[model samples]
Target: MTTEPFLAPVTTPAERREWILRLLTGTQRVDRIRRLRESIILSLLFLSALISVATTIGIIYTLSIETFHFFQRVSLIDFLTDTQWTPLFTEKHFGIWPLLTATLLVSAIAMLVALPLGLLAAIGLSEYASPRLASIVKPILEILAGVPTVVYGYFALLFVTPLLKRFIPQLEVFNALSAGLVMGIMILPLVASLSEDAMRAVPQSLREGAYALGATKLEVVWRVVVPSSLSGIVAASILAISRAIGETMIVAIAMGQVPRLTLNPLVAMETMTAYIVQVSLGDTPHGSLEYQTIFAVGTALFLITMVLNLLSYRFLQRFREVYE
Candidate 1:
């Protein structure tokens, strides 16, 4: 066998330290890094902040410009006062009410479906379930939230509508009921997760105190835990309401494109976002007043959602307690 070249033995700690120092002092890489001595950390943070600020400014500026154009053609009164909507036709009428009605109708339906189911789920997760069971179920419930809205829309349009047509034949292909119901399912995880957290935050001492006073489990939960967590529940509900209002894709697909003043759930109706989508998807000229209508509708939606979210945040802040 051929012998390899003999290497020198390792040095003592002090000798090794000296060697490392000499090497590092002469290193070109370190010298280069030292040369560009500007605060790279600060530059990165400032750049990130600049991007965020720029994005906000761009959105606001674009929306404001188009909304101004739209308002010049359609008066504020015409936009707000008129109840009838015929945007795409020869008889062009601008009305906020029909869109508002469609949005509210779907939102009301979503709330109705989400509230009770979410509350029950929250109660189960926080109060009734074992730790092992909760671990299994919570992630499963979250999967429902993870499903894409467009998929939910398809399920609503294809499955739910056909099923409903079996009983209520008058139920239109793209009615508010299917859209609202699917929206509720889409929003279920939001309500359930938040409400569960709020319910879980209630102290065990409160439940024990109620039980010590000869209260049943049902009574303890209803009187003590639920009441103490009332603010949180309300906050969660408001948050869910905010989501219901802003939901776009599901509404656009499952709800019809028709902009109608009718209150009937069976009739086809268009939401504000849906109206924007309908207009933008059409072949209207880019600079025309008609194209600008999208931004005006968007501004209206933004105002509504912003108000709702602000209210929710206020509720959460006011109602939150120091559990300690």
Candidate 2:
């Protein structure tokens, strides 16, 4: 009977070393490819971040240069203290107070309408509504945010203003009240969605603990969930306020372009964004004082938003609750 011969294994140290070297070479190739891929991904991420930083720096530089030119032509004291803001008229007055007061007035009214309603909606969604109901309602509510600002502006001008005029005969055709109310509705989703997300992020263990202490659902939500999520709530409110401040189309179309330094919500007034819109309508000369006014106003709006963001960051840092 013929038997097949068995192949011998590598017995020498040199043969074993060669096999190990081959294995290591393959592993090294795989590792090099993986590292190359990772490096490409990291570089893309860095480039994206660099683009955002560059865009912000460019905007700041442009605004600073134009604002400097503006200050050279106009006095800083008059810009801050002057109550009139007619740069278009033959008698140009550049007092920024009128626009500033109107912007604040409209934004305040918007917050008055939005804050309580948004908070209540968030509470209802997070604590009361079933998951099915929340899923259905949230998308529908966010639809309002998806609606174009120009459409909201027209809705305010055509529908809301007419309705309000019937109830309040003293209301102007173009008034801050309608504009502010519409702006509030426009930003409501931002507040509600953000606040609900924060509330939902509260740990279930915390809720169970509260329940173990015989606390009701309402009690647990208010006493535990809300305090835990206070930073997010404040952040949402500040973001909504910033949105209202920067709103251009709604204030331009419905709030009127009249820069009046009055707190009365029933009267026509102009916000900073609306004034910028009015100036940008191609009627003003490119290098004129009227042209430079938009940049100056934009600088002020940017500063205000930046300050609000800084305040929000500080508030979040101070009150943020971390959970394992």
Which has the greatest lDDT? 2
Question: C-alpha displacement of 101 in model 2, angstroms?
Answer: 0.9
How many collisions per candidate?
0, 0
1-324 per-residue lDDT for model 1 (tens digits)? 665533233267887787778788878677777766556767887899899889878888898999998888899998999987776778888888899999999999999999989988888888889978988999999999899888988999999999999999999999999999989988888888988888888888889998899999789878888888888888889999989998888889989898888778886899988888788788999878778878888888888887888888887775675453
Tell me the tens digit of each residue's lDDT in model 2 across 1-324.
564433246569998788789889999999999999999999999999899899989999999999999999999999998889999888999999999999999899889888988999999999999999999999999999999999999999999999999999999999999999999988889889989988887888899999999999889988999998998899889988888888889999999989888999999999999999988886887778988999999999999988887887776565555642
Candidate 2's displacement at residue 112, Å, is: 0.9
lDDT of residue 37 for candidate 2: 99
What's the lDDT for candidate 1? 0.86
- Cα-based TM-score, every candidate: 0.85, 0.87
List the global CA lDDT of all models. Answer: 0.86, 0.90
How much lDDT does candidate 2 score? 0.90
